[model samples]
Target: MIREITEQAWSACALRLAVDEAALRAVAEVESSGSGFLPPPSQQPKVRFEGHVFHRLTGGRFDTTAPRLSYARWDRSKYAGSSLGEWQRLEAAVALDRDAALKSASWGAFQLMGFNHAMCGFPDVERFVQAHMAGGDAQLAAFASFVDRAVFLDPLRRHDWASFARAYNGPGYAANQYDRKLAHSYARHHVPGSGTKGTIV
Candidate 1:
């Protein structure tokens, strides 16, 4: 899904948010390391599929059990370096319950959770999944929708990495230094004269 984005698509997404390209890219970098796909000045897109989500959705009915499930991420065990494990988990979970399965996994470069469909303005998770499958435009649109829902659009517009990071990544964002990372990523990507800067505070 995220792997299908073109360079123009990225610029257009940034334009939609009325943010500097660097700022948008910076957020994306911290979220998924630019998601392995950067477009024009090409960068590869890294795709992550989570199995823990499947375990939670199916109530441990599948290969892994509840006690073993880690909501923080899924690529820890069989999910590492391959999509097959997660795909199998997803297939089984979907057979048990479609909506639950969809709600279990995060999708695309931005890692938007299936449960966030409403926040992203999708009528349903199925619709969200459909759009996500269409590639970058839908994925970025979902991300923009979330930014609006979380009320971080203003912070992003101002390059307020701290505020945006807290809202986007949650209270534990500091543990990951998401704010600091945003600043550095922005500085690395933003034009020198753009007046953009990042801060942990």
Candidate 2:
């Protein structure tokens, strides 16, 4: 079954993070197009396997044997191009090294990387994956925790999309115009001077 997050969960997350609902929604929209999981039949939480991360976590152990699953650098061309394909890549990597595989993928709507499990309030990557697999509510909760731990609330509150994108997506965020996308998404969801705490509408 595909478990989705309700509007209430979004509002609650925004409230917990002390940011406008639109701001949080903007991040979610950009991260996973506003859905935490892939389409049903699988109902699995969306994931993007990062071969570079796997390579780093495994010390390039599988680079020669599994070049597609473990590379020294980020290679967008290696992606399977669909959620299903991505899952296959992940499974293949998991067979090689379960911990490294789990830690290499970005999970759920917010796309919190598995390596960030501790920062996102999970004790380990496995626990983080379990929570993401649970439902969108858990994903949102993890996002809130990540934002809190990362000190991103100030940027969100100030509508500082550039800073938020840079911090969240790293220095390469400019390549994908993540800041601009975030600003546009926020504009679409935010109501000016509404004095609303957590209402997207």
Best by lDDT: 2
lDDT of 1 by residue, 127-189 (tens): 988777766667777887887643688888877878988788778788879899989888878
Candidate 2 lDDT tens digits, 1-201: 337777888777777777888888889889998888988777799999999999999999999999999999999999999998999999999999999999999999999999999988999899999999999889988988888954488889999999898889998999999999999888888777854333333
- The 0-to-1 C-alpha lDDT of every candidate, in the order given, reads 0.66, 0.88
The total of clashing pairs for model 1 equals 6
For each candidate, what TM-score against the reference? Answer: 0.71, 0.94
**For candidate 1, which ten residues in a row score worst on lDDT?**
38-47
Which candidate's TM-score is highest? 2
The C-alpha local distance difference test score for the whole of candidate 2 amounts to: 0.88
